[model samples]
Target: MPFVWAPIPFPDTNRIDMALTDKRRNWTPEEDVVLLTQVAADLPFAADKGQVTKSWQSLADKLVACDHFDRVVDGRKVQNMFTALVDEHRKFDMASAKLSGVDQEELEKHTLLDELLPLLDEVKS
Candidate 1:
């Protein structure tokens, strides 16, 4: 079941019972860049052979095995994070793809600009 973050108000008294807060381990910006970069890089080599690519769960297992944090996240959360990164990659890919035919050099520049700029912007923020 999903977690509840709201508090329960008392009937008459000025007291309320707040649900215990869930303390999840937070990922750092450096870690985010590392993991996302890994995922993106893996995409190209994934189709190297006619064999099927590994699933997100497999990637999750690899991450968990190598992660330095004390918090142990399950495959599900890792899969979700991977999915979001893939979505962001798709967004960047689409931005570049939109300008594919105007000029070759311009397309390459636009693709590179859109790809790295947003990531830098996000990292700074």
Candidate 2:
């Protein structure tokens, strides 16, 4: 399920429309602008334009760095790690298939060694 801005209220009739919209899950430039604007407006006079902009940008960056951002420049490193783990799992499954005739204990050991070690290695790499 997509994350919802639970603090914000909406009309009952508009629930379906809001839920079905891509805006519910994805962040966009316009929404970022609006969020910055609203947050800036709430700030005291001591906060200058640069300060507000920087704070807003930082918040946006942190949100994007979170797992939900999916594929993007900021997400490349995490995506690579995720892909490597998946690939390692596939390789382990293939290796296990080749040893199908082995005893159950041996198969279990092979499964763990073939899968987890490579996945951990990639994480360290």
Candidate 3:
């Protein structure tokens, strides 16, 4: 998908809450009015395969993700990206901790065994 900046709330209104796509959420007509009014031009991208195109939607998505495009973009995309990054970092930390139990000597032994599986298999038999 092209870059995007969701949409921001109007000057007199609070921020718009972006609901999950699967969720049955509703937006008021007033909110929609504010969203359309504040949305900038050329924020979408048309598919040109190898060629790169820019539009209001793409810019909007990006702005939303960065929190800088607050006026015309949703902030959820940024939140999701951050959440994913945090999850990946946590998983990496867990995996590294689990690997700590395997000493260098044992790792080397396993590496050699893994490399000579056919010969190691013969010996095992």
Candidate 4:
């Protein structure tokens, strides 16, 4: 069955991202930008490693090394975080796919906003 939320007031914040994390600390988009920059810088080295799995593990290790802005992480945590990021992007893409005449920028705004609305509905016990 479909569920609905009662009408409640929310803050007039510009955007409230639900604070994704490795279950220990929150990761900001700014931190992600820095981490991704590091990944881009290290990707060539990771690519040189033979198998795809090893290369991914190497990347995960690098991510852990760069986790200072957030919580401490290991390869497995990095792997999980990476999977989450990919999943989020894919979900946005899938949502955008069904729409016509929507530009990437608009779609991104809508997708981010859409994700935030539900998160705002959660109440603490």
> Candidates' TM-scores?
0.38, 0.25, 0.24, 0.45
What is the C-alpha lDDT profile of model 1 across 41-115, one tens digit per residue? Answer: 444224334332344455555666765533345556655655565566668567767886655443432343346
lDDT by residue (tens digit), candidate 4, 56-115: 566666665664554555545555654565567668768878986876664433444344
Q: Is candidate 1 or candidate 3 better by lDDT?
A: 1
| CA deviation > 4 Å runs, candidate 4 | 1-23, 44-68, 106-125
Flag the better candidate by TM-score, 1 or 4.
4
Which candidate wins on TM-score? 4
In candidate 1, clashing pairs total 0
| Candidate 3 ranges with C-alpha deviation above 4 Å | 1-73, 101-125
Relative to the true structure, candidate 2 has a C-alpha RMSD (angstroms) of: 18.6
Error of 2 at 51 (Å): 28
Candidate 4 TM-score versus the reference: 0.45
Model 1 alpha-carbon drift over 4 Å, by segment: 1-23, 44-54, 67-71, 86-125
How accurate locally is residue 8 in candidate 4, as Cα lDDT from 0 to 100?
Answer: 92
Best-first order by TM-score: 4, 1, 2, 3
